[model samples]
Target: MTLGLTGLLALGLATSVLAQDYQRPSISGIGAVAQPEQIAAWDIDVRPDGLGLPVGKGTAEDGEALFADRCAMCHGDFGEGVGRWPVLTGGHGSLTEERPEKTVGSYWPYTSTLFDYIYRAMPYGDAKTLSPDEVYALSAYILAENQIVEYDQELNQDNFAQIEMPNRANFFADDRAVSEAYSERCMSGCKAEDINIVSAAPELDVTPEE
Candidate 1:
Protein backbone atom coordinates (compact mmCIF):
# COMPACT_ATOMS: atom_id res chain seq x y z
CA MET A 1 0.00 0.00 0.00
CA THR A 2 1.26 3.53 -0.96
CA LEU A 3 1.72 5.74 2.09
CA GLY A 4 0.74 9.44 2.25
CA LEU A 5 3.47 12.14 1.98
CA THR A 6 3.18 12.96 5.73
CA GLY A 7 3.36 9.23 6.67
CA LEU A 8 6.51 8.74 4.48
CA LEU A 9 8.21 11.78 6.10
CA ALA A 10 7.40 10.44 9.60
CA LEU A 11 8.84 7.00 8.68
CA GLY A 12 12.05 8.65 7.34
CA LEU A 13 12.41 10.74 10.54
CA ALA A 14 11.91 7.65 12.72
CA THR A 15 14.55 5.71 10.66
CA SER A 16 17.04 8.54 11.04
CA VAL A 17 16.52 8.60 14.83
CA LEU A 18 16.99 4.83 15.00
CA ALA A 19 20.21 5.08 12.94
CA GLN A 20 21.59 7.71 15.36
CA ASP A 21 20.63 5.61 18.35
CA TYR A 22 22.34 2.55 16.81
CA GLN A 23 25.56 4.54 16.31
CA ARG A 24 25.62 5.48 20.01
CA PRO A 25 26.40 2.24 21.84
CA SER A 26 27.66 3.80 25.07
CA ILE A 27 26.23 2.62 28.38
CA SER A 28 24.10 5.76 28.62
CA GLY A 29 23.79 5.91 24.78
CA ILE A 30 24.51 9.59 24.90
CA GLY A 31 27.46 9.94 22.48
CA ALA A 32 29.27 7.96 19.79
CA VAL A 33 32.88 6.69 20.22
CA ALA A 34 35.58 9.28 19.55
CA GLN A 35 37.59 8.50 16.41
CA PRO A 36 41.38 8.01 16.49
CA GLU A 37 42.00 11.31 14.69
CA GLN A 38 39.85 13.17 17.21
CA ILE A 39 41.76 11.61 20.14
CA ALA A 40 45.10 12.45 18.50
CA ALA A 41 44.07 16.07 18.13
CA TRP A 42 43.66 16.38 21.92
CA ASP A 43 46.66 14.21 22.92
CA ILE A 44 49.06 17.09 22.54
CA ASP A 45 50.48 17.16 26.03
CA VAL A 46 54.31 17.47 26.09
CA ARG A 47 56.26 15.70 28.79
CA PRO A 48 59.23 17.06 30.73
CA ASP A 49 61.48 14.87 28.59
CA GLY A 50 60.05 16.25 25.34
CA LEU A 51 58.10 13.14 24.56
CA GLY A 52 55.29 14.80 22.64
CA LEU A 53 57.06 17.68 20.89
CA PRO A 54 55.91 18.08 17.29
CA VAL A 55 58.27 18.12 14.33
CA GLY A 56 59.35 21.74 14.06
CA LYS A 57 62.24 24.12 14.80
CA GLY A 58 62.77 27.80 15.64
CA THR A 59 65.27 30.18 17.25
CA ALA A 60 65.03 33.19 19.52
CA GLU A 61 65.65 35.50 16.60
CA ASP A 62 62.80 33.89 14.67
CA GLY A 63 60.52 34.37 17.67
CA GLU A 64 61.49 38.00 18.42
CA ALA A 65 59.17 39.37 15.75
CA LEU A 66 56.35 36.95 16.59
CA PHE A 67 56.54 37.87 20.28
CA ALA A 68 56.44 41.59 19.50
CA ASP A 69 53.41 41.22 17.24
CA ARG A 70 51.47 38.64 19.24
CA CYS A 71 52.73 38.75 22.84
CA ALA A 72 54.28 42.18 23.55
CA MET A 73 50.97 43.71 24.68
CA CYS A 74 50.74 41.39 27.67
CA HIS A 75 54.27 39.99 28.20
CA GLY A 76 56.13 43.23 27.39
CA ASP A 77 58.93 43.67 24.82
CA PHE A 78 61.32 41.28 26.58
CA GLY A 79 59.13 39.01 28.70
CA GLU A 80 59.15 41.53 31.56
CA GLY A 81 55.33 41.54 31.63
CA VAL A 82 52.85 44.40 31.36
CA GLY A 83 51.01 46.30 34.16
CA ARG A 84 49.50 43.36 36.06
CA TRP A 85 50.44 40.48 33.77
CA PRO A 86 52.83 37.73 34.88
CA VAL A 87 56.53 38.51 34.63
CA LEU A 88 58.39 35.96 32.46
CA THR A 89 62.00 36.97 33.14
CA GLY A 90 64.53 38.14 35.76
CA GLY A 91 63.17 36.50 38.92
CA HIS A 92 66.37 34.54 39.61
CA GLY A 93 67.24 34.06 43.33
CA SER A 94 64.03 35.79 44.36
CA LEU A 95 62.14 32.64 45.33
CA THR A 96 63.27 33.17 48.96
CA GLU A 97 62.32 36.84 49.13
CA GLU A 98 59.24 38.24 50.91
CA ARG A 99 57.39 38.74 47.61
CA PRO A 100 58.98 36.27 45.27
CA GLU A 101 58.62 36.99 41.57
CA LYS A 102 58.04 33.47 40.30
CA THR A 103 58.76 34.12 36.66
CA VAL A 104 59.45 31.37 34.10
CA GLY A 105 63.21 31.88 34.48
CA SER A 106 63.13 31.40 38.24
CA TYR A 107 60.46 28.80 39.01
CA TRP A 108 59.54 26.62 36.03
CA PRO A 109 60.96 23.10 36.33
CA TYR A 110 60.97 22.14 32.64
CA THR A 111 61.29 23.78 29.23
CA SER A 112 58.58 21.46 27.91
CA THR A 113 56.09 23.33 30.12
CA LEU A 114 56.81 26.51 28.15
CA PHE A 115 56.17 24.80 24.82
CA ASP A 116 53.15 22.92 26.09
CA TYR A 117 51.53 25.98 27.69
CA ILE A 118 52.04 28.21 24.67
CA TYR A 119 50.74 25.52 22.29
CA ARG A 120 47.75 24.72 24.51
CA ALA A 121 46.76 28.24 25.62
CA MET A 122 48.35 31.59 24.94
CA PRO A 123 48.22 35.04 23.27
CA TYR A 124 45.52 35.99 25.84
CA GLY A 125 42.11 35.39 24.24
CA ASP A 126 43.38 33.52 21.17
CA ALA A 127 44.30 30.05 22.36
CA LYS A 128 45.55 27.07 20.30
CA THR A 129 46.03 29.37 17.34
CA LEU A 130 49.81 29.13 17.01
CA SER A 131 51.59 26.75 14.66
CA PRO A 132 54.24 24.32 15.91
CA ASP A 133 57.11 26.41 14.57
CA GLU A 134 55.61 29.56 16.09
CA VAL A 135 55.33 27.91 19.49
CA TYR A 136 58.95 26.70 19.23
CA ALA A 137 60.10 30.19 18.34
CA LEU A 138 58.21 31.74 21.23
CA SER A 139 59.55 29.15 23.65
CA ALA A 140 63.09 29.80 22.42
CA TYR A 141 62.65 33.56 22.77
CA ILE A 142 61.42 33.24 26.34
CA LEU A 143 64.33 30.91 27.14
CA ALA A 144 66.76 33.41 25.67
CA GLU A 145 65.25 36.33 27.60
CA ASN A 146 65.60 34.23 30.77
CA GLN A 147 69.27 33.51 29.88
CA ILE A 148 68.61 29.77 29.73
CA VAL A 149 69.36 29.48 26.01
CA GLU A 150 71.40 31.50 23.51
CA TYR A 151 69.57 33.89 21.15
CA ASP A 152 70.53 31.74 18.14
CA GLN A 153 69.97 28.37 19.79
CA GLU A 154 67.46 26.37 17.80
CA LEU A 155 64.63 24.51 19.57
CA ASN A 156 63.05 21.43 18.04
CA GLN A 157 61.79 17.99 18.95
CA ASP A 158 65.31 16.50 18.83
CA ASN A 159 67.09 19.07 21.02
CA PHE A 160 64.12 20.09 23.13
CA ALA A 161 65.01 17.53 25.80
CA GLN A 162 68.58 18.89 26.16
CA ILE A 163 67.36 22.35 27.18
CA GLU A 164 66.98 21.87 30.92
CA MET A 165 65.18 24.38 33.10
CA PRO A 166 67.13 26.00 35.97
CA ASN A 167 64.69 24.92 38.64
CA ARG A 168 64.60 21.30 37.50
CA ALA A 169 66.56 20.13 40.53
CA ASN A 170 64.10 21.73 42.95
CA PHE A 171 61.18 19.61 41.70
CA PHE A 172 61.11 16.08 43.05
CA ALA A 173 58.62 13.29 42.60
CA ASP A 174 55.63 13.33 44.96
CA ASP A 175 56.69 10.90 47.71
CA ARG A 176 53.97 11.87 50.18
CA ALA A 177 52.49 8.39 49.96
CA VAL A 178 55.75 6.86 51.25
CA SER A 179 57.28 9.81 53.13
CA GLU A 180 54.24 10.94 55.10
CA ALA A 181 53.04 8.92 58.07
CA TYR A 182 49.33 8.20 57.97
CA SER A 183 47.53 7.84 61.27
CA GLU A 184 44.08 6.54 62.11
CA ARG A 185 41.16 8.55 60.68
CA CYS A 186 40.15 11.23 63.17
CA MET A 187 36.74 12.77 62.55
CA SER A 188 36.25 14.16 66.08
CA GLY A 189 38.87 15.50 68.54
CA CYS A 190 41.23 16.23 65.65
CA LYS A 191 42.46 19.25 67.62
CA ALA A 192 44.19 18.85 70.97
CA GLU A 193 41.79 21.06 73.01
CA ASP A 194 38.40 22.81 72.74
CA ILE A 195 38.21 25.71 70.32
CA ASN A 196 37.97 29.26 71.78
CA ILE A 197 36.70 32.25 69.84
CA VAL A 198 38.55 35.51 70.37
CA SER A 199 36.17 37.53 68.15
CA ALA A 200 32.79 37.26 66.41
CA ALA A 201 31.58 38.45 63.01
CA PRO A 202 29.21 41.05 64.58
CA GLU A 203 31.97 42.34 66.93
CA LEU A 204 34.28 42.75 63.93
CA ASP A 205 31.42 44.52 62.08
CA VAL A 206 32.15 42.45 58.98
CA THR A 207 28.74 40.75 58.83
CA PRO A 208 25.60 42.51 57.52
CA GLU A 209 22.49 42.67 59.74
CA GLU A 210 19.05 41.87 58.43
Candidate 2:
Protein backbone atom coordinates (compact mmCIF):
# COMPACT_ATOMS: atom_id res chain seq x y z
CA MET A 1 0.00 0.00 0.00
CA THR A 2 2.85 2.40 0.82
CA LEU A 3 4.66 1.60 -2.50
CA GLY A 4 1.47 2.07 -4.49
CA LEU A 5 0.79 5.45 -2.80
CA THR A 6 4.38 6.52 -3.52
CA GLY A 7 4.04 5.51 -7.22
CA LEU A 8 0.74 7.34 -7.56
CA LEU A 9 2.22 10.47 -5.94
CA ALA A 10 5.21 10.30 -8.26
CA LEU A 11 2.95 9.94 -11.33
CA GLY A 12 0.80 12.84 -10.17
CA LEU A 13 3.88 14.98 -9.62
CA ALA A 14 5.24 14.05 -13.08
CA THR A 15 1.92 14.92 -14.69
CA SER A 16 1.83 18.27 -12.88
CA VAL A 17 5.40 18.99 -13.96
CA LEU A 18 4.56 18.12 -17.60
CA ALA A 19 1.51 20.31 -17.52
CA GLN A 20 3.56 23.21 -16.09
CA ASP A 21 6.24 22.73 -18.80
CA TYR A 22 3.81 23.33 -21.64
CA GLN A 23 4.06 27.11 -22.22
CA ARG A 24 3.66 29.41 -25.27
CA PRO A 25 5.93 32.26 -26.22
CA SER A 26 5.06 35.70 -24.87
CA ILE A 27 4.63 37.27 -28.32
CA SER A 28 2.03 35.65 -30.68
CA GLY A 29 -0.54 38.29 -31.66
CA ILE A 30 -0.80 40.08 -35.07
CA GLY A 31 0.87 43.17 -33.61
CA ALA A 32 3.84 41.16 -32.34
CA VAL A 33 5.27 40.78 -35.88
CA ALA A 34 3.97 44.09 -37.25
CA GLN A 35 6.19 47.19 -37.34
CA PRO A 36 4.00 50.28 -37.64
CA GLU A 37 6.81 52.73 -38.45
CA GLN A 38 8.29 50.65 -41.33
CA ILE A 39 5.23 51.33 -43.54
CA ALA A 40 5.47 55.15 -43.34
CA ALA A 41 8.13 55.42 -46.05
CA TRP A 42 6.15 53.32 -48.56
CA ASP A 43 2.75 54.93 -47.85
CA ILE A 44 3.23 58.19 -49.73
CA ASP A 45 0.10 59.20 -51.63
CA VAL A 46 -1.64 62.51 -52.37
CA ARG A 47 -5.43 62.77 -52.38
CA PRO A 48 -7.93 65.11 -54.01
CA ASP A 49 -8.51 68.53 -52.39
CA GLY A 50 -4.70 68.67 -52.18
CA LEU A 51 -4.53 66.69 -48.97
CA GLY A 52 -1.05 65.19 -49.33
CA LEU A 53 0.93 67.52 -51.68
CA PRO A 54 4.33 68.33 -50.27
CA VAL A 55 5.47 71.94 -50.10
CA GLY A 56 7.13 73.12 -53.33
CA LYS A 57 6.74 75.40 -56.35
CA GLY A 58 7.31 75.07 -60.11
CA THR A 59 6.35 77.15 -63.14
CA ALA A 60 5.07 75.82 -66.43
CA GLU A 61 8.19 77.16 -68.13
CA ASP A 62 10.45 75.30 -65.73
CA GLY A 63 8.26 72.22 -66.14
CA GLU A 64 8.69 72.41 -69.92
CA ALA A 65 12.45 72.40 -69.55
CA LEU A 66 12.41 69.46 -67.15
CA PHE A 67 9.90 67.59 -69.28
CA ALA A 68 12.05 68.01 -72.38
CA ASP A 69 15.08 66.62 -70.61
CA ARG A 70 13.59 63.84 -68.47
CA CYS A 71 9.95 63.22 -69.42
CA ALA A 72 9.87 63.85 -73.19
CA MET A 73 11.77 60.63 -73.97
CA CYS A 74 8.72 58.58 -73.03
CA HIS A 75 5.86 61.13 -72.92
CA GLY A 76 6.85 62.84 -76.18
CA ASP A 77 7.77 66.52 -76.59
CA PHE A 78 4.06 67.60 -76.76
CA GLY A 79 2.93 65.44 -73.78
CA GLU A 80 1.61 62.82 -76.21
CA GLY A 81 2.54 59.37 -74.94
CA VAL A 82 4.94 57.29 -77.03
CA GLY A 83 3.77 54.44 -79.32
CA ARG A 84 1.66 52.56 -76.75
CA TRP A 85 2.42 54.25 -73.43
CA PRO A 86 -0.52 56.69 -73.19
CA VAL A 87 -1.70 60.16 -74.26
CA LEU A 88 -1.63 62.86 -71.58
CA THR A 89 -3.54 65.64 -73.29
CA GLY A 90 -6.95 66.02 -75.05
CA GLY A 91 -9.99 63.67 -74.50
CA HIS A 92 -12.05 66.59 -73.25
CA GLY A 93 -15.61 65.41 -74.04
CA SER A 94 -15.09 61.69 -74.65
CA LEU A 95 -16.07 60.44 -71.18
CA THR A 96 -19.76 60.20 -72.17
CA GLU A 97 -19.03 57.68 -74.93
CA GLU A 98 -18.82 53.90 -74.63
CA ARG A 99 -15.06 53.75 -74.93
CA PRO A 100 -13.52 56.98 -73.72
CA GLU A 101 -9.77 57.37 -74.12
CA LYS A 102 -9.26 59.13 -70.82
CA THR A 103 -6.24 61.37 -70.31
CA VAL A 104 -4.77 63.47 -67.50
CA GLY A 105 -6.83 66.49 -68.47
CA SER A 106 -10.14 64.80 -69.31
CA TYR A 107 -10.59 61.83 -66.97
CA TRP A 108 -8.81 62.91 -63.82
CA PRO A 109 -11.26 64.37 -61.35
CA TYR A 110 -8.72 66.44 -59.41
CA THR A 111 -5.64 68.30 -60.64
CA SER A 112 -3.80 67.42 -57.45
CA THR A 113 -4.02 63.72 -58.39
CA LEU A 114 -1.79 64.47 -61.40
CA PHE A 115 0.91 66.02 -59.24
CA ASP A 116 0.55 63.20 -56.75
CA TYR A 117 0.80 60.40 -59.33
CA ILE A 118 3.70 61.95 -61.27
CA TYR A 119 5.65 62.95 -58.21
CA ARG A 120 5.36 59.50 -56.70
CA ALA A 121 5.75 57.30 -59.81
CA MET A 122 6.91 59.16 -62.94
CA PRO A 123 10.07 59.16 -65.13
CA TYR A 124 9.29 55.36 -65.45
CA GLY A 125 12.81 54.12 -64.71
CA ASP A 126 13.90 56.23 -61.74
CA ALA A 127 11.08 57.01 -59.32
CA LYS A 128 10.94 59.21 -56.14
CA THR A 129 14.17 61.02 -57.15
CA LEU A 130 12.65 64.32 -58.29
CA SER A 131 12.80 67.22 -55.89
CA PRO A 132 9.60 68.95 -54.84
CA ASP A 133 10.45 71.79 -57.24
CA GLU A 134 11.06 69.35 -60.09
CA VAL A 135 7.79 67.53 -59.42
CA TYR A 136 5.93 70.83 -59.42
CA ALA A 137 7.60 71.81 -62.71
CA LEU A 138 6.82 68.45 -64.32
CA SER A 139 3.21 68.78 -63.17
CA ALA A 140 3.05 72.28 -64.63
CA TYR A 141 4.39 71.21 -68.01
CA ILE A 142 1.98 68.29 -68.25
CA LEU A 143 -0.93 70.50 -67.27
CA ALA A 144 0.10 73.09 -69.88
CA GLU A 145 0.34 70.44 -72.60
CA ASN A 146 -3.11 69.26 -71.59
CA GLN A 147 -4.25 72.92 -71.95
CA ILE A 148 -5.63 72.88 -68.41
CA VAL A 149 -3.41 75.75 -67.37
CA GLU A 150 -1.38 78.48 -69.11
CA TYR A 151 2.33 78.06 -69.81
CA ASP A 152 3.36 81.05 -67.66
CA GLN A 153 1.39 80.16 -64.58
CA GLU A 154 3.27 79.22 -61.41
CA LEU A 155 2.18 76.08 -59.54
CA ASN A 156 2.88 76.14 -55.86
CA GLN A 157 1.46 74.57 -52.71
CA ASP A 158 -1.13 77.33 -52.46
CA ASN A 159 -2.35 77.58 -56.07
CA PHE A 160 -1.86 73.96 -57.14
CA ALA A 161 -4.73 72.83 -54.92
CA GLN A 162 -7.00 75.61 -56.13
CA ILE A 163 -6.69 74.77 -59.85
CA GLU A 164 -10.15 73.51 -60.78
CA MET A 165 -10.36 70.45 -63.03
CA PRO A 166 -12.95 69.97 -65.78
CA ASN A 167 -13.90 66.56 -64.40
CA ARG A 168 -13.98 67.60 -60.78
CA ALA A 169 -17.58 66.50 -60.35
CA ASN A 170 -17.40 63.64 -62.84
CA PHE A 171 -16.58 61.00 -60.24
CA PHE A 172 -19.13 59.63 -57.79
CA ALA A 173 -18.45 57.29 -54.92
CA ASP A 174 -20.09 53.81 -54.73
CA ASP A 175 -23.81 54.58 -54.45
CA ARG A 176 -24.93 50.92 -54.47
CA ALA A 177 -23.97 50.47 -50.84
CA VAL A 178 -25.74 53.60 -49.64
CA SER A 179 -28.44 54.44 -52.24
CA GLU A 180 -29.27 50.97 -53.66
CA ALA A 181 -29.84 49.20 -50.35
CA TYR A 182 -33.50 48.69 -51.28
CA SER A 183 -32.59 46.95 -54.53
CA GLU A 184 -30.24 44.59 -52.75
CA ARG A 185 -32.86 43.78 -50.08
CA CYS A 186 -35.72 43.16 -52.57
CA MET A 187 -34.54 39.64 -53.55
CA SER A 188 -37.32 37.79 -51.70
CA GLY A 189 -38.29 35.55 -54.67
CA CYS A 190 -34.89 34.40 -55.88
CA LYS A 191 -34.91 33.57 -59.63
CA ALA A 192 -31.66 31.85 -60.62
CA GLU A 193 -32.75 31.55 -64.29
CA ASP A 194 -33.35 35.29 -64.57
CA ILE A 195 -29.72 36.06 -63.76
CA ASN A 196 -27.78 37.56 -66.68
CA ILE A 197 -25.18 34.95 -67.59
CA VAL A 198 -23.84 37.11 -70.43
CA SER A 199 -22.63 39.84 -68.04
CA ALA A 200 -21.13 37.62 -65.34
CA ALA A 201 -19.04 34.54 -66.05
CA PRO A 202 -19.55 31.66 -63.61
CA GLU A 203 -15.95 30.49 -63.44
CA LEU A 204 -12.77 29.99 -65.46
CA ASP A 205 -13.47 27.22 -68.00
CA VAL A 206 -10.08 25.72 -68.71
CA THR A 207 -11.46 22.78 -70.74
CA PRO A 208 -13.46 23.18 -73.98
CA GLU A 209 -16.68 21.93 -72.51
CA GLU A 210 -20.10 22.60 -74.10
Candidate 3:
Protein backbone atom coordinates (compact mmCIF):
# COMPACT_ATOMS: atom_id res chain seq x y z
CA MET A 1 0.00 0.00 0.00
CA THR A 2 2.88 2.39 0.85
CA LEU A 3 4.62 1.61 -2.44
CA GLY A 4 1.38 2.19 -4.40
CA LEU A 5 0.87 5.54 -2.62
CA THR A 6 4.47 6.65 -3.38
CA GLY A 7 4.01 5.78 -7.10
CA LEU A 8 0.68 7.72 -7.23
CA LEU A 9 2.30 10.82 -5.60
CA ALA A 10 5.21 10.74 -8.06
CA LEU A 11 2.76 10.44 -10.99
CA GLY A 12 0.74 13.40 -9.71
CA LEU A 13 3.89 15.53 -9.26
CA ALA A 14 5.08 14.64 -12.79
CA THR A 15 1.64 15.54 -14.23
CA SER A 16 1.66 18.89 -12.39
CA VAL A 17 5.16 19.66 -13.66
CA LEU A 18 4.15 18.83 -17.22
CA ALA A 19 1.06 21.04 -16.91
CA GLN A 20 3.16 23.93 -15.57
CA ASP A 21 5.69 23.53 -18.40
CA TYR A 22 3.04 23.96 -21.11
CA GLN A 23 3.50 27.09 -23.15
CA ARG A 24 0.60 29.40 -24.02
CA PRO A 25 -0.09 30.42 -27.62
CA SER A 26 1.91 33.49 -28.63
CA ILE A 27 -0.47 34.64 -31.35
CA SER A 28 -1.75 38.24 -31.01
CA GLY A 29 -4.59 40.08 -32.75
CA ILE A 30 -3.88 42.22 -35.82
CA GLY A 31 -5.26 45.31 -34.09
CA ALA A 32 -2.53 45.16 -31.45
CA VAL A 33 -0.39 47.47 -33.62
CA ALA A 34 -1.24 50.20 -36.08
CA GLN A 35 -1.45 49.05 -39.67
CA PRO A 36 0.83 50.53 -42.35
CA GLU A 37 -2.21 52.06 -44.04
CA GLN A 38 -2.95 53.92 -40.80
CA ILE A 39 0.16 56.05 -41.30
CA ALA A 40 -1.99 58.84 -42.63
CA ALA A 41 -3.66 59.21 -39.23
CA TRP A 42 -0.55 60.43 -37.35
CA ASP A 43 2.51 60.49 -39.58
CA ILE A 44 3.46 64.14 -39.24
CA ASP A 45 7.25 64.46 -39.19
CA VAL A 46 9.66 67.00 -40.72
CA ARG A 47 12.89 65.27 -41.61
CA PRO A 48 16.26 66.82 -42.39
CA ASP A 49 16.74 67.86 -46.03
CA GLY A 50 12.99 68.56 -45.93
CA LEU A 51 11.72 65.11 -46.84
CA GLY A 52 8.48 64.63 -44.92
CA LEU A 53 7.56 68.23 -44.03
CA PRO A 54 3.96 69.20 -44.68
CA VAL A 55 2.39 72.22 -46.42
CA GLY A 56 1.28 75.26 -44.30
CA LYS A 57 3.22 78.28 -43.16
CA GLY A 58 3.82 80.16 -39.92
CA THR A 59 5.87 83.25 -39.22
CA ALA A 60 7.71 84.03 -35.95
CA GLU A 61 5.24 86.80 -35.19
CA ASP A 62 2.38 84.41 -35.69
CA GLY A 63 4.03 81.87 -33.38
CA GLU A 64 4.48 84.28 -30.47
CA ALA A 65 0.81 84.16 -29.52
CA LEU A 66 0.78 80.37 -29.62
CA PHE A 67 3.89 80.22 -27.46
CA ALA A 68 2.49 82.52 -24.79
CA ASP A 69 -0.79 80.63 -24.65
CA ARG A 70 0.60 77.08 -24.91
CA CYS A 71 4.32 77.00 -24.08
CA ALA A 72 5.34 79.88 -21.76
CA MET A 73 3.85 78.10 -18.72
CA CYS A 74 6.59 75.45 -18.66
CA HIS A 75 9.33 76.70 -20.98
CA GLY A 76 9.19 80.30 -19.68
CA ASP A 77 8.57 83.40 -21.80
CA PHE A 78 12.09 83.38 -23.26
CA GLY A 79 12.53 79.59 -23.34
CA GLU A 80 14.71 79.51 -20.20
CA GLY A 81 12.83 76.50 -18.78
CA VAL A 82 10.85 76.28 -15.54
CA GLY A 83 11.75 74.03 -12.61
CA ARG A 84 12.83 70.74 -14.27
CA TRP A 85 11.21 71.32 -17.66
CA PRO A 86 13.58 71.49 -20.61
CA VAL A 87 15.22 74.72 -21.63
CA LEU A 88 14.43 75.44 -25.25
CA THR A 89 17.56 77.49 -25.99
CA GLY A 90 21.20 78.13 -24.96
CA GLY A 91 23.97 75.60 -24.03
CA HIS A 92 26.21 76.99 -26.79
CA GLY A 93 29.53 75.79 -25.30
CA SER A 94 28.53 72.96 -22.96
CA LEU A 95 28.99 70.06 -25.40
CA THR A 96 32.64 69.31 -24.48
CA GLU A 97 31.91 69.24 -20.73
CA GLU A 98 30.91 66.16 -18.69
CA ARG A 99 27.84 67.70 -17.04
CA PRO A 100 24.22 67.58 -18.25
CA GLU A 101 24.56 69.94 -21.17
CA LYS A 102 21.27 70.37 -23.05
CA THR A 103 18.87 72.69 -24.87
CA VAL A 104 16.81 72.45 -28.01
CA GLY A 105 19.53 74.48 -29.73
CA SER A 106 22.31 72.29 -28.34
CA TYR A 107 21.09 68.72 -27.86
CA TRP A 108 18.38 67.78 -30.35
CA PRO A 109 19.67 65.77 -33.31
CA TYR A 110 16.84 65.64 -35.84
CA THR A 111 14.39 68.46 -36.37
CA SER A 112 11.67 65.92 -37.11
CA THR A 113 11.83 64.60 -33.56
CA LEU A 114 10.90 68.07 -32.38
CA PHE A 115 7.71 68.30 -34.44
CA ASP A 116 6.78 64.73 -33.51
CA TYR A 117 7.47 65.10 -29.78
CA ILE A 118 5.53 68.35 -29.49
CA TYR A 119 2.66 67.30 -31.69
CA ARG A 120 2.27 64.06 -29.71
CA ALA A 121 2.90 65.62 -26.31
CA MET A 122 2.60 69.29 -25.43
CA PRO A 123 0.53 71.99 -23.60
CA TYR A 124 1.14 69.95 -20.35
CA GLY A 125 -2.40 68.65 -20.09
CA ASP A 126 -3.90 68.69 -23.56
CA ALA A 127 -2.03 66.74 -26.22
CA LYS A 128 -2.97 66.46 -29.88
CA THR A 129 -5.22 69.44 -29.30
CA LEU A 130 -3.13 71.80 -31.36
CA SER A 131 -4.03 71.97 -34.99
CA PRO A 132 -1.32 71.39 -37.57
CA ASP A 133 -1.27 75.11 -38.21
CA GLU A 134 -0.86 75.84 -34.50
CA VAL A 135 1.94 73.29 -34.23
CA TYR A 136 3.75 74.88 -37.15
CA ALA A 137 3.37 78.28 -35.55
CA LEU A 138 4.60 77.06 -32.17
CA SER A 139 7.50 75.26 -33.79
CA ALA A 140 8.42 78.38 -35.69
CA TYR A 141 8.35 80.42 -32.51
CA ILE A 142 10.56 77.94 -30.65
CA LEU A 143 13.03 77.79 -33.54
CA ALA A 144 13.32 81.55 -33.60
CA GLU A 145 13.88 81.59 -29.83
CA ASN A 146 16.72 79.09 -30.33
CA GLN A 147 18.13 81.32 -33.10
CA ILE A 148 17.99 78.41 -35.54
CA VAL A 149 15.70 80.40 -37.84
CA GLU A 150 15.24 84.07 -38.55
CA TYR A 151 12.33 85.94 -36.95
CA ASP A 152 10.78 86.79 -40.30
CA GLN A 153 11.34 83.31 -41.65
CA GLU A 154 8.33 81.14 -42.26
CA LEU A 155 8.09 77.47 -41.26
CA ASN A 156 5.86 74.66 -42.40
CA GLN A 157 6.23 71.10 -43.60
CA ASP A 158 7.92 72.66 -46.65
CA ASN A 159 10.74 74.42 -44.81
CA PHE A 160 10.75 72.98 -41.29
CA ALA A 161 13.67 70.58 -41.79
CA GLN A 162 15.89 73.32 -43.26
CA ILE A 163 16.19 74.95 -39.84
CA GLU A 164 19.51 73.41 -38.78
CA MET A 165 20.15 72.90 -35.06
CA PRO A 166 23.23 74.61 -33.53
CA ASN A 167 24.57 71.43 -31.91
CA ARG A 168 23.70 69.09 -34.75
CA ALA A 169 27.36 68.60 -35.58
CA ASN A 170 28.31 68.00 -31.93
CA PHE A 171 27.39 64.29 -32.04
CA PHE A 172 29.34 61.63 -33.91
CA ALA A 173 29.10 57.86 -34.25
CA ASP A 174 30.55 55.95 -31.25
CA ASP A 175 33.52 54.06 -32.70
CA ARG A 176 35.66 54.12 -29.58
CA ALA A 177 37.77 51.26 -28.18
CA VAL A 178 35.02 50.51 -25.64
CA SER A 179 32.76 49.23 -28.41
CA GLU A 180 35.25 46.48 -29.39
CA ALA A 181 36.49 45.75 -25.83
CA TYR A 182 33.33 43.92 -24.77
CA SER A 183 33.52 41.39 -27.62
CA GLU A 184 37.19 40.52 -26.97
CA ARG A 185 36.72 39.51 -23.31
CA CYS A 186 33.90 38.45 -20.99
CA MET A 187 34.87 37.69 -17.34
CA SER A 188 38.51 38.70 -16.92
CA GLY A 189 40.31 41.93 -17.95
CA CYS A 190 37.08 43.43 -19.29
CA LYS A 191 37.55 46.64 -17.40
CA ALA A 192 39.69 48.45 -14.86
CA GLU A 193 39.17 48.43 -11.07
CA ASP A 194 37.32 51.26 -9.35
CA ILE A 195 39.67 54.17 -8.73
CA ASN A 196 37.44 56.81 -7.13
CA ILE A 197 35.54 56.71 -3.82
CA VAL A 198 32.06 58.28 -3.53
CA SER A 199 31.61 58.86 0.19
CA ALA A 200 29.17 61.62 1.18
CA ALA A 201 30.54 64.91 2.42
CA PRO A 202 29.87 66.03 6.02
CA GLU A 203 26.72 68.08 6.45
CA LEU A 204 26.92 71.63 7.81
CA ASP A 205 25.57 71.99 11.39
CA VAL A 206 22.91 74.62 12.02
CA THR A 207 21.81 75.94 15.45
CA PRO A 208 18.11 76.37 16.27
CA GLU A 209 16.73 79.87 16.77
CA GLU A 210 16.31 80.93 20.45
Best by TM-score: 1
Query: lDDT of each structure?
Result: 0.91, 0.80, 0.77
lDDT of 1 by residue, 1-40 (tens): 8899999999888766554467655578678999999989
Top-lDDT candidate index: 1
- Report how far off residue 157 is in candidate 3 (Å): 2.0
lDDT per residue, candidate 2, 136-184, as tens digits?
8888888888788888898988889888888878888788977666644
- Model 1 ranges with Cα > 4 A deviation: 1-31, 173-210
User: Using Cα atoms with residue i matched to residue i, what is each candidate's TM-score against the true structure?
Assistant: 0.69, 0.66, 0.66
Tell me which of candidates 1 and 3 scores higher on TM-score. 1
lDDT of 1 at 151: 96
Quote the positional error of residue 58 for candidate 2 in Å.
Answer: 0.6
Superposition error at 82 for model 2 (Å): 1.2
